[model samples]
Target: MTAGIGHPMETQGSGAPGAGGGAIGLDELDLSIVHALQIQPRAPWTLVGSVLEIDPVTAARRWARLRDVGAAWVDGYLSPAQEDMTWAQLEIAVNGARLMDVVRTLCDDAGVLSLKQTSGSRDLVALVQARDVDTLAEYVSERVCRVPGVQGARVHVITATPFEGSQWRLRSLDAGQRERLRQFDETRPAPGTPVTAEPLRPVERRIAVALGTDGRMPLAALAREVDASVATTRRALGRLLNSGRLALRCNLARPLTGWPVSAMYFASVPAEHLDATATALRTLPELRFCTMTAGPHNLFLDVWLRTLHDVHALEAHISRELGHLRLRVEERAVILRTFKHVGRVLDRHGHSVRSVPINTWK
Candidate 1:
């Protein structure tokens, strides 16, 4: 296995690390830990160990390694449909010299969740959520297009996300396999105290991978596939569900349903008043997301709307809220295709055998 290939992937960080910073190397154990967590982030070490048949000490060591390396993190993801909202992806065309500035501004806004600098016709890609079309337009025209350095922008409203996050079940690392991955643990510490009494083994990983691929499989089928009893399979799956690591939801595309106008806009706001300004921006019904960030301009926001009139209303409201903030509308762009979504796993190398109890947050 290559470096960094076996682990659960991390979000691309800022070019520079924060105060205490460094890069993490991937090993076989890290891969196994990641694969198990991917199945259920909240799983207890005891259960994981039991499932894998390893003592708690080894499992704890593996889990700690993954955390230290930043291979995995727990985060929340809510379905837009659950809240009666819509999701969209935006592409912004900006002056190359000011690309970083543009991205920073968008990050500070709350509505904007994730941003990336890309190597295509567009310089930045953003994700935004909104309640309706009018608010989305207001977000674009009044807040985004007017940003000082922006040239243009486009929006591709997300229709559905069939699959997202679930990387652990895809990994295949046993005690022996993990040893092989330790290419150079020169100063690695001697194994320490137990962090938990359970961890997933190779067989458990096999069960997880099966579920990750298809959450709707019948219990009998899953038991047969994983070579476990029906009762055991049910228990394991229940633990995974309670863990917050595995989630299943409906995926739908908006374009196929009739709402097809994907719009983009820009805005320029001042740094000091960015928070207040973004707060006002969110009051509109159309906006799904917004934020403030480090950039030439103070704030960046994105929204998705369906009609021209609604867009006009949202823009007018944003302008009125800014009063004399001297914000300018910049650029907007749309998306035509998606290579991947949130939860799709990037690597598929290993499996686990044991079952573990999961730790879930309320």
Candidate 2:
């Protein structure tokens, strides 16, 4: 499975590394550790060390350091089952003085899954989830707009999530390492199957809470957190995995990976060619996030690149290839800072610093 937002493998570093002087630095070994975990997020340190030709204790210590400084992390969240769930992307215009207050209020709401401060006409962007269309309308129209200082709000209902944060990878691992790591990876269910919403049991909720902060938590430790036998916890986890109710993401520090710039594009595409267009865009490695939304601009894309110059090249490529689909660029927004991704809160440098579990049913 791909790493989710903020659920990246820990990279050993002192501080933000790529900025040079004053930023923490990462060596090749640190990168190797990260690549290994990206391939197999829950691999034991001993096994990971063996693959990297290091001692287990050394690997553990390196991870601890990375985790302590918010350099790397792993997180878990419930995936969208085949249920009647509504996912909406919101663009909120807020007063400058009350921006922080508005952000805090939205962040506390369980419906808001991800929040980002961006450079564009909108002051903030939020990804929210609700049970159905009416509930989503209530949250966005009544609740979000009612927040103090929220001057305006635009809601984009996500009709199809062609790609998500979890599918994006660092592509740092070699074929051999990735092949070896796959042996320990868990199996995910095939996509497109109709899934009904099943309320999580109390024990399951506790387990999800524990895993949200650390996807690699030992099964024994997870059992203790939920106050259940290891066997029982493992069985429940297996059920959750088989049902595609829970997802574990292995994410990384993008700055260290030489891809620092992130840009989001909103475009309008012809309805007849929407599926074909989304299918083609999915193959591009640069795309980290893509979704089909119902709004003035129906197609949304988030891409990461090595440099700012690459954005132009990407735009040109899109125009040249999908131009026949009549995809019109509406707006482009550069992510200024990400406060929360998935269920984890990030620092200015895009490090996973903390967790606030998402309640999809809430």
Q: Give each model's clash number.
A: 83, 4
Error of 2 at 354 (Å): 2.0
Cα lDDT tens digits for candidate 2, 1-362:
12122222233333364222246667777777777776677888878888777899999888776666667777777664334367888999999999989977887777788898989799999998887899888888799999999998889988888777776665556688778777774333345544445666777777766787788899999999889998888867766665667767776666766667788889989999898888888777778788888889988898886567766777777877788888877788888877888877766677766677777554
Q: How much lDDT does candidate 1 score?
A: 0.46
lDDT of 1 by residue, 125-191 (tens): 7666555666766777776777767887786665433222221133244555344333322122335
TM-score for candidate 1, please give it.
0.43
Q: What are the models' TM-scores? A: 0.43, 0.85
Stretches of model 2 off by over 4 angstroms after superposition: 1-22, 80-84, 185-202
